[model samples]
Target chain A: MRQINGQPVTTTNSQTRERILEAAEAVFGDNGYHDAIVDAIGRRTSLSKGGLYFHFPSKERLFFAVLDRLADRLVSKAEEAAAGDGPALDRAEQALRAVLTALSRKRRLARLLMVQGYSMGNQFERKRAEIFDRFAAVIEGRLREAVLNGEMVEADPALTARIWLGAVNELVIHWLHAGGPSPAQRADEVAVVLMGGVRAPMPVPMPAELAR
Target chain B: MRQINGQPVTTTNSQTRERILEAAEAVFGDNGYHDAIVDAIGRRTSLSKGGLYFHFPSKERLFFAVLDRLADRLVSKAEEAAAGDGPALDRAEQALRAVLTALSRKRRLARLLMVQGYSMGNQFERKRAEIFDRFAAVIEGRLREAVLNGEMVEADPALTARIWLGAVNELVIHWLHAGGPSPAQRADEVAVVLMGGVRAPMPVPMPAELAR
Candidate 1:
């Protein structure tokens, strides 16, 4: 049995996989998606390219795996938070705040997931969408709860959820790109704008054909 | 003189450079930054790579030049709209509306400027900052005028401007990524949120921290 990072590789493939992922996250975050290489990821675990491949077939697969891990963590946290005893509005805010804190601490991983996610297609994109859908589901559930609780007016919960998600993602990207303040500040601002609108929907102009 | 895009290429070096920039915008919008090439840009005007090189040494430089042109146009439009005859609030809204419209119409350029801008450093970054600063100045001026004219409450004009800019940019990215309905709806929502406060600024946090 080969010894790697003071762990016996033969004992558990799952443990080895976890280590490889952690290493991948660090490399991808530090050097960016375009610059990170498989060799670099393997070196962190004192493993060869073959060892890394045994766990993740390609960098794209590894990237998606890392993203999946983060997304799952977010979903689990949101579900757990939302299910907790609290006001609907407060629950939503708490869930989002947790997400922002997690993202802030994992700046490199967050950046990679965002900037590269949009450009990636094929298998990588499938995983990205899955993660997005998972988060969206949580938001939708919270929105439904809000509507039921009368904390928010009845509207398209899914659409509203997507809009909130978009706003949060955009704020993070700008924050990352500009090297501005912490994500907490951005999260607070986003929360304000999102929750600021009147409980009533604004009068939107309808197209002539639609009106007819 | 050699034939160039069926034109005589008689304009001054600077003017010809400007013409090439205009053409590049049209071409880049049709294609995309990574997919766009110098030859396609040359086909739009009487400028070869050699001639273009005289002005911009590389494809990336030409792309930056295009971004510069668009930035200048937006800033100039904002300046004109701000200085023109209208209510201070109306003028500020008009200027922002103009910016949002321009960004939506030039989606490719907006994406290029955003994605590539992050990857650039040193001179390119400085150039990008210079252009962004020009627009920021326009926003600040109008904000100051709004407070002076009593159209808006007194606050940090600079911070207000950045917050608004950040919102618009975030919305633009969201609109693009979602492949959704008109951006105007979301843009209007943002404008309303900024113009008014969510929860009336909490009645005691003052308006400074709440502005963002």
Candidate 2:
């Protein structure tokens, strides 16, 4: 095992890192990036300042770590759902629902990742865009499959995927703002609205004679 | 004519104010709230620091003035389109297109309002939300009229409006990022996708079966 400060590194070190991350998530989510401090995060964990600094050198690095962990979890859930056996659109819907469920469970993390993270600086903005692109790529792959399987209309998968992602983003932001519907309910609504659109039902064509 | 600092203020005074605002928009849009300074704005406007200060007292006030002007312009254009003599959905589409047109023309202002303004802290966030609410209110009014006129399915106008606004916001942001299609073209695509949805068309029922 690696030695640090004359103590052999063990699983406890990893656990301490995890605890610090969780505490950082809560603090950053609550106070935002500017007001968040390492000491506050350390207070929440069993670690002292030295232990916390051992894991994360600075507040910026700690914030990014929290965001990275959150993004990984979200992406993993989405990927799992997307990989399930089903119609492509159904899988896509499932993936979105999975992501939204995870987000609802971690609302603070969601705010930090989606809201505050974007405003930090150019570097953070690029990270945010890259994460969105990851989601879009996943969605695009599913959409391509849907088009091939005749489960959806043929369109530019890339553009359609991006538009879909945008809709989902907006829906999540709105859910955060209003706070009424459950993630599952909102997911259903979003899937329906995005898939079917809000247009009135088209009238069925009458028989030729009736039309004449 | 009003005189300040032993000089006569004429229509030139109004022109000077407009000049100051235009310069301020570019400055704030490019550098953001904190980095943007009144001196830079004065340099752009051919005005002395005293001249700029005469028109706007502080950076906060100047920033809000730019935002308020942009918001007013957008809201007015949207209102004009929404109040047109057309079906509610069509009017809504038109309103969205109008806003997009204005946004495309004033991309810097758009960035300032949508991206930077949201992160400037609680005051600007509230202002951004209020502006979004104004747009949503217009959309909701149109949606309510559509439901009454049998042009749309009955739904929560408020919620639907907010969702639609979110969709538009995402589309615009994506446009800013991707930079290919014209705003009008993108607006058309958005309207079609949003109103019609991405689902495959349902099979039309047979008339003979219906007659039976």
Candidate 3:
């Protein structure tokens, strides 16, 4: 096994990466992307600049890695809430609630998730879309079930998922960046507006006693 | 009257500004904020760099001016569609259709409104928020009547308008930048999802007559 500085290179390299990401999240979350410095992360992780660069080459890559971890955490929360035998709509709500609750607990997490990348432009926008799409896929799967179970009117699940995620994105922006009500408080209302569109259409009544 | 180039200052000043805005819109819309050259706008307007600088001072301001003009056009379109004795919900739909139809007719206009300034970051995002808020207020006005007239289930008109606008914004973005289907094609479905949420609740039953 390869050893560096009397430690296994493989294990320490991963541990160092995990450490760097944790510290980077705090730094990035505290100061935002533009204000943050590599040295600050290096100091936070007890690594030299050379060591930091050895693991992740640039600040942009490091920042996005932090975002990926955050996104992965949120996606799992959404999927876990969405899983099981519950009615799909309720599960969808649970997924929404899970995300909102998690965000509400940590303002910094919310900022990192929604606000930090505003300055980074195209790459960040694409990343935001990718993360939102990940969340949408989880919800879209549940919504497809909701439709199949006759819980909703016939509607395109893919489009509905995108729209639903968009509304949530707006709601979070209002709460976090725009000085509006917290999303947890507004979660049900958002659901009503978005979900109402899909509520099952008036069921087609079977022809009543046509034989008569 | 102050005249440097043989034209009356006040009359030509306003006309010059108007001319610059028109030419700048074409340039910025075609090449985006970063790629579009100020000199291109100057050339298109038959004005020198000094003449162009005489009106708007910087490219950022010039770009925002174009966006503001476009947003104003959209805002007025929404208000006009909403300005009738017909049902408010239909008016909202009309407003949505009007905007989407206009956008479908011109990809560049849609790009200018929804896609450009995307790379410019904070200033652009703020401008976007401002423009969206303008559209939201117009729709909110109609939705207020929609709620009062029992056209929708009880909903916060302000929030509903924001979410509705957010959905439309996302649709346009997907259509323009993300290779998604045209928003014009999905306009009705967009309406169903967002409007469904605000739909008026099932009404209270009239009390049985005590006289009976």
List residue ranges in candidate 2 displaced over 4 A: A1-13, A37-39, A42-54, A198-212, B1-17, B45-58, B198-212
Highest lDDT, which number?
Answer: 3
* Residue runs of model 3 more than 4 Å from their true location after superposition: A1-11, A26-49, A201-212, B1-52, B115-118, B123-125, B201-212
- In model 1, residue pairs whose N, Cα or C atoms come closer than 3 Å (at least 3 residues apart or on different chains), thus clashing, are B4-B46
TM-score, candidate number 2: 0.81
* Cα shift from native, residue B210, model 3 (Å): 22
Which lDDT tens digits does candidate 1 get at residues A72-148? 77778777766777767667767777776666776776776655543332224345556766777787777778778
| DockQ of each candidate relative to the true complex | 0.11, 0.32, 0.33
Backbone clash pairs for candidate 3 read: A193-B197, B152-B199, B152-B200, B153-B199, B153-B200, B153-B201
TM-score of chain A of each: 0.81, 0.81, 0.84
Q: lDDT tens digits, residues B131-170, model 1?
A: 6567767877877777787666555565456555655655
Tens digit per residue, CA lDDT, model 3, A98-155: 8877887787898778766644544565777788789989988988999999998778
lDDT of each: 0.65, 0.72, 0.79
Per-residue error (Å), model 3, residue A180: 3.2
Taking chain A of candidate 1, what TM-score results?
0.81
Write down the TM-score of model 2's second chain: 0.83
